[model samples]
Target: MKIMTCPFNGPRPVSEFFYWGEIRPMPDPATCSDESWADYIFNRNGAPGVKQEWWCHIASNTWFIAERNTEKDLVLRTYLFEEEL
Candidate 1:
């Protein structure tokens, strides 16, 4: 079984975590055009590469970011959201 290291809860079975979608920037709603907003909501690059994504621990309700390689489906690192700054 695969293990995912949670920033707060240490290592756990991958089954204990939920895969959230990729992390992407959102444009300012006030200044963004309708087309831009629509594209942002519906479009995805879908390229195979390293990307940041969100994951959550089921029992602890902890949310964190995982830097992963899409091609290998390997999680390179896990960190708290604030630590990304």
Candidate 2:
């Protein structure tokens, strides 16, 4: 079974966690056009590569960021939203 190390909860089975989605920057809603806002909400870069994504630990209700390599299906590291590793 795959193991994911939660930033706060340590190592645990991957099954205990949920993948949210890739972290992307949101355009400033005040200055951005409608088309830009729509595109930001609906589109994602689906290319296979290293990406930082949001993940949640179900039991503990912990939220964190996971940097993973999609091509190899590997998680490089996990950290809280305010941290990097």
Candidate 3:
């Protein structure tokens, strides 16, 4: 079983967190084009690299960011959502 370290709360079971989706460069829907909307909403490339993904701490009801190393099945970094930091 893989372990996930929450940047806010420290180590926890992977199953305790839910994979929300990819962290987008731009999250606004009104400004996005049709193709961009489709890609953001439905398309995802399962490639190996540093990817920004959304993760929700189900038990805590908190949301956070996870920088994932796909090839290694490792989380490079994790952090709480800070609008400015």
Candidate achieving higher lDDT, 1 or 3:
1
lDDT of 2 by residue, 1-85 (tens): 9999999999999999999999999999999999999999999989999999999999999999999999998999999987754
Task: Name the 10 consecutive residues with the lowest summed lDDT in model 3.
Answer: 20-29
| Deviating ranges (above 4 Å) for candidate 2 | none
Of candidate 2, the 10-residue stretch with the lowest lDDT total is: 76-85
TM-scores for all predictions: 0.92, 0.92, 0.78
Clashes of 1: 0
C-alpha RMSD values across all candidates: 1.0, 1.6, 2.3
Clashing pairs in 1: none
Question: What does the lDDT read for residue 12 in candidate 2?
Answer: 99
Report lDDT per candidate: 0.94, 0.95, 0.83
Q: Which regions of candidate 3 deviate over 4 angstroms?
A: 26-32
- Candidate 1 local lDDT, 1-85, one digit each (tens): 9889899999999999999889989999899999999999999979999999999999999999999999998989999999878
List the pairs of residues colliding in candidate 3: none
